[model samples]
Target: MDDKYYTFSYKLRGDYKASPQYFFVGTHCANEFLDITKHDPLPLFNPLVHEQENHSPGNSPSSSSGDNKRLHPFNQELLTAINMLCISWDIIPKSGLDKIITFTRRRSETPNYNGIEWFNQIVGKDRQRRSLRIMIDQLRENNELKDLRFDESNNYLNERDIVNNIN
Candidate 1:
């Protein structure tokens, strides 16, 4: 199956409403769940490989030895949905939208969604909530910068910061 790319855009708030941020997201059609149990082999599908080299510098894993943990079932479902729902996006530093950043597949030596650790890792723990819409909204509301640049700056309001306030 061929991968398809679409131009995704989100409008900023106030004066920036005229010019929205643009992103190129790649997606495919066939991703229906077949209810594979832990014993069943994972389905044969193309994993999301990024085309852009926009990885965030100094973005090391927050986890360490013996820190391996699993998420609650409800949180696991939400994480899985966010991870696998979108294939690939161009933005990187805005990692709240990246797929499987906190937790990874079992085979990759990270916390597996179906592992014995019970899919460990809280979604928004010390990080932005894994969401695009919420991120955009927070960017509009939190940041004084009208352009919505994701650079390392205090002016920009990260969703992680606001999420803590909400909770």
Candidate 2:
């Protein structure tokens, strides 16, 4: 059970041997964890799942109303904004966008506040196009991705648009 003497190895060693030559196996997820060495860790941040969803923005809730109706958490709101464009077919898109808008308006005293900077960072530069690719790929046979594109409608509000309006 000496961790230092034996780094974790892919092959279950029947007998102990001190050798760096052993290939450390990727995650036990098999297909899911395929090629771990070439990739970053699954949970890439202190708060992991959030980052996987785009970022690990930590969050909690507060409300001026005290009624809990508008008391949605901050991270949830941030995530909601990001989801407006970079969608996933898994679950919660329209609702996520609503939460984003609602949370920003309620929280930010600045009329200049918009979620675009964050959105860009989440999906990376030109991620809007990347998001489109993801959505389009979802339509293919192998890419049964969830449908979460926000621009499918003319009325879809965007954070960058809001920022432009404020500016």
Candidate 3:
């Protein structure tokens, strides 16, 4: 009956007969909570899964290509840089790349927009190459990353190319 706590209850509406469940809110204890939803929940993000996949057998950038020879050193370097940026940003590479492109395009719309100036403002001049902006630019400019196909302006990926690559 404390002022900070209250009872909450819910019940299923269907033919399944069950008593309502009660939850006491406003407990100061950190672990005292229940998930009262009817459906299962999935994680919004899992960095460990991506980290494991990156180090797994045959998942390396060199091995991903078809010719059996390692990827071009520049391509390899770019991929490594991009992977490091992804780790720092705590985002998956595919979605992260998309977000970078979207952010860049939005920034470009301003009158007298300057890519280098804006990027330096956000990431600082010293760390440009290691920053998300530079990593995304390198990825978009590289032809060796066959899974991606950029438009003429390099603003977005072709949906058909992405689907074909996936299959």
Candidate 4:
């Protein structure tokens, strides 16, 4: 199948509209997929006491929770949807998993979906179809992903790639 079919763009709708945003999820577009995942904040699943550490450049995780109540709920459903797509495509790296867990822990303290209107826009019928198509194409391209197999399930792909390159 042509790789172009796997790429998709969705319109962001709201009282304040912006230009259309595109996302690609496929074996050949790992970087693009990571770019999107990295930017999209995941919901904080665990309640960590190191609220101040999140803001600090290099602080211990053992710090006390300061103003932890500020954490608000972002588009967790969207994050999960993206994660399932990543898993289906075997694109998720350890960094991606860490991002999922940490982002959920840190960003959940102050959930902000304003920067990611596409999360909400994806709920629409048309946009949902487009997103699902992208995921479907990714699954079709990777046989391992078809059976729900993950590449380097323990270690993250990005870190593993970096280590292999350095070696």
Candidate 5:
């Protein structure tokens, strides 16, 4: 029998007080795991779903006025935060804000997609997720986003106080 292992380490960009560094290690077989010859390549990220959702019932031509309505404040703030964090960390590039905004707008047009899941997909890989998680943890530890708390009523982060904090 043969055995193999993979190990990696990474650091967050800024001076976060909670945790400054991170490391990870895992075990797997090169033949079974690293070998992707049999698997299909990942599909291109598609915006078609967003397009379709925009044309759906409540948002159809007859109700075009709905397009003028603003996205929920909480969701808007969350996307802004994600964009800011990603750009600060250089995860997505200078256009990260545009990508985040486009993605968020698409998701907003679609009621069925899970926002958290969509976020995870955009981050795309484990390393990025780790970096983002650390940043969020630091933010929570420092109470930077104290105004954005989970609301029991809506089962999502409350954004009533987030308006003043966004900048």
Candidate 6:
């Protein structure tokens, strides 16, 4: 299949006459259950039934409580769905796993998603701030000109050429 891209936005609060929280982005055929790659997966599942099983990142083999075993029979169904998607697509998950963890307890304005502790370790404490300062300066001064040229011929192949390439 050719590459496809989607941008998902959760419903921002306002009375749009629709459910304020449920707005999601998806391909024409995709549904909420299949959006685990983009957001937290558990909320879409049966809320009353699911026992929280904390499998650390990379499925660390930590044992779940005894109740978890009883739930495993039903949990396998969830696994099957995920397995099928993994089998078909490369599953290049654009959203980081850390965001799912954070979404559970806190609101977005409280604490921003984590940065994996490496950017500060390697690039020093001020690198991010310095980069942002430079970006803001360029924006305000309007001195950083963007290259506004494109090679149209290379990108826009004639219909005949496109058909020929496909054939």
Candidate 4: regions farther than 4 A off: 1-73, 94-101, 114-130, 133-167
Residue 15 in candidate 1 has what lDDT? Answer: 62
Overall lDDT per candidate, in order of appearance? 0.32, 0.33, 0.33, 0.36, 0.38, 0.27
Q: What lDDT is reached at residue 41 by model 5?
A: 19
Positional deviation of residue 80's Cα in model 4 after best superposition, in angstroms: 0.7
- Runs in model 1 deviating more than 4 A are 3-40, 43-72, 81-131, 134-167
Please report the candidate that would top lDDT against the real structure: 5
Judged by lDDT relative to the true structure, which candidate is superior, 4 or 6? 4
Model 2, residue pairs in steric clash: 50-55, 51-55, 51-56, 89-146, 89-147
Cα deviation of 57, candidate 5, in Å: 35
Per-residue lDDT, model 1, residue 104, is 46
Q: How many backbone clashes does candidate 6 have?
A: 0
- The 10-residue segment with the lowest total lDDT in model 3: 40-49
TM-score of 5: 0.31
- Residue pairs clashing in model 3 are none
User: How many Å off is the CA of 68 in candidate 3?
Assistant: 2.9
lDDT of 1 at 92: 28
lDDT per residue for candidate 1 within 1-167, as digits (tens), equals 33443333456667652544556543331111112221211222222233334322111223222344443443333343343223222232133332343334332443332321221222233254444334434544643322322222111223234322111
Preferred candidate (lDDT higher): 2 or 6: 2
Per-residue CA lDDT of model 5 for 1-167, tens digit only, reads 32212222234656543332323233333223324444221111111123333222222322322245455554554554554465336454223344444465656544322443344344444344454445555556644443433222123322322212122
lDDT of 4 by residue, 88-133 (tens): 4455323234345345546665543332233223322332344443
Q: Which stretches of candidate 6 lie above 4 Å from their native place?
A: 1-106, 113-130, 143-167
* TM-score versus the correct structure, for each prediction: 0.20, 0.24, 0.25, 0.25, 0.31, 0.18
Model 3 lDDT tens row, 1-167: 42233234456778345644545554222113323333222111121222333232232333321234333332332333334445455444342343343344344333212322232233332243354434544655642332321122122113223211101
lDDT against true structure, model 1: 0.32
The candidate with the higher lDDT, 2 or 4, is: 4
